[model samples]
Target: MTEIQAGLTVCTVLVVPYIVQAIKTKAMTGNVARWIAISVSTLCGVLTAMAGGMPTDASAWVTSIFAAVGGVQVAYAAFRSVGVTDKWLDALLALGDIKED
Candidate 1:
C-alpha cells in the first residue's frame, strides 16, 4: 500500500475502538485518554499530508505514520475530555452502531 493509505490504515486500527466505546457508553468521560491520543494522531496525519512528498523514505514515512496514529488517539481522548455532547461527536460514534431501520 502507498504511504498515505498505510498511515491511514494504522490510524484507523488504533482509533476505532475508542470511538466505539464512546458511542456505546455515551459517556465522554470514559474516553478522555483515548480522545487525546487520537487527536494527536489526527494532527500528525494532517501534518504529514501537508508535508507532502514521497512516503517511500522509511524514516520519514514511519515517523509520519506513527505521529498520525498518535494524533488520532489523542483526538479521541480529547473529544471525550471536552465534557460536552454535540451532534458531531454523537454522529461520529453512531457511525459504527446499528442503524435502527
Candidate 2:
C-alpha cells in the first residue's frame, strides 16, 4: 500500500474508537469534553479520507464512510442531549407549513 493509505489507515484505527466513545459517554462526561473528542475525530477522519483518495479501493473509502457516520451520530446525540426529539426534527423539516395558532 501507498504511504498515504498507510497513514490514513493508522489514523482511522486510532480515531474511530475515540469518536465512538465520545458519543457514547457524552451524557456522563459533559458536552465540552465530548465535543472536543468529536471535533478531533472529525478532523482526523476528513484528513484520512482526503489522503485515501477516490473510492477505487475498500480501505480508501471505509475511513470516509465511517467518519461521516460518526459525525452524524455525534450530531444526533448532541440534539438528543438538549431534549430535541424526533418530532422536533420532523417539525424542522416542515418549516414551510409552520403553524402559529
Candidate 3:
C-alpha cells in the first residue's frame, strides 16, 4: 500500500482499540493513564500528519477527525476525573459513563 494508506491503517489499528476499551470500561477514573496516552498519541498523529509530508486528501481527513474525537474524549475524561459536573460536562462525561471519584 501507499505511505498514506499505511499510515492511516496504522493509526486506525492503534486508535480503534483504545476507543473500544474506553467505551467498554464505562469509567474513566482509573483509566487516566490510557486517556493521557491516547491524547498524546492523537496529538502526535496530528503533528506527524502536518510535518511528515503525508497525503492530506483522505488519510489526513480521517486522522484529523479521529484525533479530534479522541482529544475530546480525553478532555472529557480529565474533567470527569476532577469531579466537575455541569450540563455540558455531564453530556460529554456521559459519553463514557465516567463518574467522579
Candidate 4:
C-alpha cells in the first residue's frame, strides 16, 4: 500500500475502537445513539487532522478543519451530557447552593 493509505489505515484502526468503547459504556444516561454519534464525530476530528497533513491534497486543509470543528462541538456536548464538569465550576456552583435544601 502507499504511505498515505497505510497511515490512514493505521489511524483508522486506532480510532475506531475508542469510538466503539465509548458507545459500549453505560456510565452516561440520555440517548445512547447520541453518544455513538459523538464518538464518530470525534473520529472525524482525527481524520481531519490526518487528512489536513496530506501533501497531495490542498482542499483537505480547509475541509478537514471544518470537520474537526464539528467534531469538537459533538465532543463537548458529549462531555457535558456525561457530567464531566470542571472542578472550579463545580465549586462555584456549590457556593451558591445549600447543603440541605
Clashes of each: 26, 0, 0, 0
Error of 3 at 53 (Å): 3.1
Prediction RMSDs, each to the true structure: 8.2, 11.3, 10.5, 10.9
lDDT of 2 by residue, 1-101 (tens): 45775566455544454444434432655566555555666566656666645457666556564654475455556655664533454455468785788
Off by over 4 Å in 3: 1-5, 8-29, 51-101
Rank ordering of all candidates by lDDT, starting from the highest: 1, 2, 3, 4
Q: What is the C-alpha lDDT of each candidate?
A: 0.56, 0.55, 0.54, 0.49
The per-residue C-alpha lDDT of model 3 at residue 74 equals 58
Residues 1-101 of candidate 1: C-alpha lDDT, one tens digit per residue: 45765566566645554555545544456457455446655565645654556555576666665666754555545655774334555676669899778
Task: Give, for candidate 2, the lowest lDDT window spanning 10 residues.
Answer: 17-26
Which lDDT tens digits does candidate 4 get at residues 40-79?
6555644655653544565554444445445445444555
In TM-score terms, which candidate is top?
A: 1
Number of clashing residue pairs, candidate 4: 0
**What TM-score does candidate 2 get on C-alpha atoms?**
0.34
What ranges in model 1 sit over 4 Å off? 1-51, 84-88, 91-101
Model 1, position 49, has a per-residue lDDT of 50
What TM-score does each of the candidates earn? 0.37, 0.34, 0.31, 0.32
* Error in Å for residue 83 of model 4: 0.8
Q: For candidate 1, give the lDDT.
A: 0.56
lDDT of 3 by residue, 21-48 (tens): 4454345554664555566556655655
